[model samples]
Target: MHIAEGFLPVTHCVAWAAVATPFVAHGAVAVKKQLKAQPETKLLLAAAGAFSFVLSAIKIPSVTGSSSHPTGTALGAVLFKPPVMALLGTLVLFFQALLLAHGGITTLGANVFAMAIVGPWVAYGVWRASRGAGASMDLAVFLAALLGNLATYVVTATQLALAHHAQGLVQAWLTFMGLYAPTQVPIAVIEAIVTVLIVRALSKIAVPELQRLGFLPEPAQPVAQKVGI
Candidate 1:
């Protein structure tokens, strides 16, 4: 959910910026630490970031004024964790502003909060929890990707409601959710399936890489079945 430039009130923009800054700082530090430990992952990191960037850019029109796209953060979050995704997501959003002219500078903080901070963390939580509960990789991946994208829109709706609602916050929240849920439901399913597909590919082509990233044990067997995206 890319928020257009100058759409949010100044106070909301400033508040969100202030809140998101520390997470970005932590993300950068975490990435540096990861690189120091696993230099081989540099290329993997690039590919993961590119996946998030490229998928999010293909927006599908939704509601009256906004559009939907796969956040694409869930896969990276599951592999690399949420902090690095936050850092990479910030750069992705900034690049989208500069190149695609989708989300804007003014609203970067809010967008980052939704897509980077909350989305990844939620997805990662679901992933870990599901895995801990002995869920299948496919099921964990699907839940992570699906719920993460939904969380992004939920947070965005909350931000919008807080900033612009003439009605009370609850009412505004409900309104925005109603507006986004229709298209977002299908989009979430599509994004989750795509994420599973990508992870399945990585598991096959990059088994060693996945082992190094702690996504799989060194002796793990392949689990990719015929999955429809």
Candidate 2:
């Protein structure tokens, strides 16, 4: 669902770039801190970046000439922190735009805002909530992935509405949401199931890997109070 360059008006592009700059900067700093805190995480992040790039490229056609694909934010957030996921996503998008031409440079900021910022943060938020309640990790991961994918479309719809507004199009924001939600929701559900299955298998074989990668907290000797995210 990468919005091409020139799809949005120049004004919207400039506005989104301005708004997204600080978040992008903050995300980069967080990634740097993560690398320093755990040097091995750099390898994990690179692997996730490569994985995301490949995953996002495999798309299923949707209405409106858009396509559905795995957001990959859930996997990243489950392996690394959300901020780190954002960095990984940015790198993946950069390479995709450069090599594959999957997305455009001009719309990079908006794409990052939708997929990287909104998706990972949504997943992380759900993960945190579920973990605090001592919910099953598998279930939490599923819901987090589901919400992240759904939120990507929501954010994209908002961005599109904003672009239309700048261009004086008659379409309303709610209208855009209404049109996009029908297509996005079903795909999101499928993504959630896939993510849950993968995480479940990973948890069985490599629980410590999850912990080391910051997906799960260090296990307590007797299992301490539940923590989220």
Candidate 3:
């Protein structure tokens, strides 16, 4: 969900931009370190960014009148972790705003916070948590995408509620959430399935790249060849 241009108050926009700055900065640092460690990550990073831009740009109208779509942050978060994913995600947001007019500059901070930073960070946590809880990679990836998509909508609703704090914040928040949930819930489920598909394809051919990016464990085993009789 994007907060359209000038939709938020100036103060609200500036406040969110301010809040998102350091996280972006930290993400930049993480990107630098990752590139230094695994130069091959650049191509994968580009693919991840492109994935986010393509999927997230396909916004379907929702009850909020704002529209909803897949975040695509789960793939990046699972592959690169939040710090790196946050950096990549912001790039996607900026480009979409600049070239595609999908989002806007004033609301850039708020959008970035919701879709880029918080969503990926939460997804990364869910991915790790699910993996630690002995879930399969498929399940982990699904939960990451599903929960991450939900988290983004939640953050967007909160931002709208805060901006309209003239209305009771709690009521506004719940109202905004109610408006978005119908579209977002189904979008989240679709995103989870899509993420699993993407991960499965990558797992088959990009084990080294995935392992290098820390998505796969060290000493990753090669995919076993299936011999046809």
Most lDDT-accurate candidate: 1
Ranking by lDDT: 1, 3, 2
lDDT tens readout by residue for model 1, 158-221:
9989987888889999988888887889999999999999999999988888899989986844
Question: How many residue pairs clash per model?
Answer: 0, 0, 0
Lowest summed lDDT across 10 adjacent residues in model 3 is found at 220-229
| Whole-structure CA lDDT of model 3 | 0.89
Local distance difference test values of all predictions, in order:
0.92, 0.77, 0.89
| Per-model TM against the reference | 0.94, 0.84, 0.92
lDDT of 2: 0.77
- 1 or 2, which is superior by lDDT? 1
State the lDDT of candidate 2 residue by residue for 141-198, as single tens digits. 8889999888888888788887777545446567677666666778788888878877
Residue lDDT tens for model 3, 13-46: 9999999999899999998998898898788888
TM-score of 3: 0.92
- lDDT for model 1 comes to 0.92
- Sort by TM-score, best first: 1, 3, 2
Clashing residue pairs in candidate 1 are: none
